[model samples]
Target chain A: MDSSPPYLSILGVFALLSVLAVGGGAAVLPETKALTVTHFHWLADDEFRDIYGLGQLSPGPNMLMVIAIGYWVAGYPGAALAFFGFFLPSSFICFGASRLWNRFEGSQWRLAIQRGMAPIVVGLMAAGTVSVARVAIEGWITAALALAVFGILLARKINPAYLVAVGGVVGYFFLV
Target chain B: MSEAAPAPTAPAAPAGPVPLREIFLTFLLIGATSFGGGVVAYLRNSLVRAKKWLDEDQFLEALEISQTLPGLNATNMSVIVGDRLRGPWGSVAAFLGMTLPGAAMMTALGVMYALHKDHAVVSSVLVGVGAAAVGLLASVTIQVGRKQLEHVLDLSIVAATVLMISVFHISMPIVLLVLGPIAVFIYRPHPKRIHLRRRHHGHDIKPAD
Candidate 1:
């Protein structure tokens, strides 16, 4: 039933995902995984995991990795499409909503909405954590690494990028 | 009027419009430096402590708007905070700065990955990186939600959300549609207990003294 050019399909998928990303990229992890891996066949599970890892190594938003996905599927054009399609719609929404929210600064429902959505956001984040873990926490070694990193982080405020790099060194010498 | 006029300290302080170049460069600095996913702390240090662009309340207000929107809180916060200081151009400037570095870096890395998919070292290292990232993502999620997870009602909603998404495999739009209003209704503003305004954003999580 696929009928469109690859670029258009890529654009359409992310553009829709951009709007549906209500609580942030993590909130939409399951859907994003489903779209890119299951629906579009853009990447395999292991490759997706690797790309997600690469995205984390970068400094800004985690989901900017979608650009990588776009690149894999359709080269430079696909990457451009993903960058524009994925970011534009939501950026516009954030831009417009921020102004409107400020304009109605004292709206009666503002607090209520913020408070109510808080738990939902938490739940979505947890779901996202689980989704990532399902793919990444494969064996005893990875599970131990993930657990160790988790405990260290919860206990203290160390920068994670360093830890991730150290893990690559560990993997290079031992896991391989 | 009581509600419209924020407390004596209006946070952003509006202190005349900031120069657009200042806005762009500062955000660009944040973009280049903020590593891992800890941009929030870096943002506070730069924008609030250093530049005095927003007071605590103003920063939290903008944070609420960022978290409530569909994009990443990082970029959304940049755009909103930028707009507060300047205007549309400010929003555009901040967003560009916030996203440009990572986008360029990822493009280069992805291109390299595409060229060499079968390199044993790359795959192995990436596997380790991916595993470590799971831990980091999990830690970030817990830290962000620690407050919301404390209460029983909020706990249940969080559980419901996780269950529906992870276990039941419900679509996001459906899940949001069904649970969003219910969550809000339970937390609906009650004027009778006017004590609600104090910790709206939970920016500082110290237990009440």
Candidate 2:
């Protein structure tokens, strides 16, 4: 682990993922999991699952797991470097793009591009959902919980924080 | 009597620049408290409700644009809001304010990981958190799907992507590369007319031929 240059790799992987991570960072979950768990073997499947859990529970973006991954690989330096490398490129890209986007704000072609993007983004997100479920739902109870959450979300307007809190309490007693 | 006649006017507060320190602190607070998967909702609550910095429609527009872009929606939203509030420097401030805490926390966890590689309590907490995360991810999927997926073609693409990735174990980059072009070609809309529906409307329009 010490010699693996895991921090460097984390930066590289996240930079790549950031570019392709359209529709939110969820779109990159499958790739990130595969690279971190399956390809690199830096983290076990369960560990990857746990890190992802932390990312979800923590404030801010769920993709903040990159920092956790970096930290796990190296140390504080790794975390700091990974955070800087991963976020800076994407932040600059977005900032510049936003400025340009405003210029074409009224273009029908721009509207068309956005329309075309909707399905692709949705498709990517759906893929991400499956990727997460496949890893997290190991048993019947967990699977049932996943489905229940899905149903609850689809049917009503429950705030997501409440759902996470309830799931945490239930899982602490039952699954843990 | 002279003092009463002079009834000194209260010193006019110096109208200086909004303190960057205050802005950074506010951003940090928003980042720390924005938990449980509702980044957008938490952002609204913090920025609009708590700080009163942005109005509802402004926040919504920023959210819409953020979702359309490639990055974390919350981060992207922060960039937009930061840019609006304090220009480019403010954007950097917001980005740092948002990410610093998570980075520090994760780094601490990493240190703990080095020492306690096989601790049961750590494992158990992670297990519990992992289970809860599944629920969170599922909820997000359904919520985003309802709002974004309207057309049957959109739903079909979603189903296909899920099946391809989950069942076939296809690489995501390849999936995106393959599907991206197809989506662009198939879903691209034909050029349409742009008309000013009302005079004096502030709709930013390109020069008409």
Docking class of 2: medium
lDDT per residue for candidate 2 within A11-91, as digits (tens), equals: 787787787777777777887888878887878877787777667666767788777777776667667666776677778
TM-score of chain A of each: 0.91, 0.91
Candidate 1 C-alpha lDDT tens digits along B20-94: 888888888898887777677778788877777887667767777887788887888888988877778999999
Model 1 regions lying over 4 Å from their true place: A1-5, B1-17, B192-194, B197-209
Best by DockQ: 1
> Candidate 2 — which residues are off by over 4 angstroms?
A1-4, B1-17, B50-52, B191-209
For all predicted structures, in order, the TM-scores are 0.90, 0.84
B-chain TM-scores per prediction = 0.84, 0.77
Candidate 2 residue B87 Cα shift, in angstroms, is: 1.9
Chain B only: TM-score of model 2: 0.77
Q: For model 2 chain B, give the 10-residue run with minimal summed lDDT.
A: B200-209
